[model samples]
Target: MASVQKETIIDADPADVWAVIGDFIDGPTRMAPGFVTNSRLEEPEVRIVTFADGTVAHERLIARDDQTRRIVYSVVGGTMHPTHDNASMQVFPHSEGRSRFVWIRDMQPDDLAIEVGAGMGHGLSVFKQTMESPR
Candidate 1:
């Protein structure tokens, strides 16, 4: 299995960050607008996400904890078919007006780790830019 973790501190309140990421259905589009072109819920627990690079993924929500500001999901089907793919995003309070955003992805087939990690890195960068921008 390949496990990749990426984290960054955003210059925003934890609650504010949660408000954006907690939506699950629309969070990706909002968090990384250009990177994630569109995201919609196929069902209560299933989401279909379209990326800017023409990659689409059907992700199922595994868990969501409001108190802990964490959301877990798994990609069931998409352009890149993997035996196992699970990911989680969480926000933690940092300083008075900053929050730490952490993203972790675990998947089968170690070779995919590099590509997946690069995507995660780019996504996080866009997310940080979006969150820090004036709203």
Candidate 2:
């Protein structure tokens, strides 16, 4: 089992940050260049992203808690996913009108979990950098 969590403080407003994060398909475009091969709308607004490395992950808008500004998303299923069962989250918070992005990935096991989770944490760091850097 593995678990990874990453948090970043951005100077932009939470809404501005969510504007970028909401584009789930753009995760590859903005989060990691060349990482996402393609993404399709599974339904009205749900998206499934296929990675260049062959990981197919599904994401749906689980819920939007306005009070917390937390955009809940989940991986219903995927191939070569972080684990046989995987779940993640993107927590958005407004601190002094700035956006604080929190990414959390929960997977089972210990050793392998840290490896995968750390990789994810690094990826999320890239995402934060790209999203916040004059884009």
Question: Best-fitting candidate, measured by lDDT?
Answer: 1
Q: Candidate 2 has which clashing residue pairs, if any?
A: 1-108, 1-109, 2-107, 2-108, 2-113
Clashes of each: 0, 5
Please provide, for model 2 over 1-135, each residue's C-alpha lDDT reduced to its tens digit, 9 standing for 90 to 100: 456677878777777667656565564455656655688778864778786677787776666555565555766666644344344445466587677788666655455566566557666776667666775
How well does candidate 2 score on lDDT at residue 116? 61
Measure candidate 2: CA RMSD. Answer: 3.2
Q: Give the winner by TM-score.
A: 1
lDDT of 1: 0.95
Off by over 4 Å in 2: 24-28, 44-46, 81-97, 109-112
| lDDT of residue 113 for candidate 1 | 96
Candidate 1 on 46-90: residue-level lDDT in tens?
999999999999999999999999999999997988899999999
lDDT, residue 19, model 1 = 93
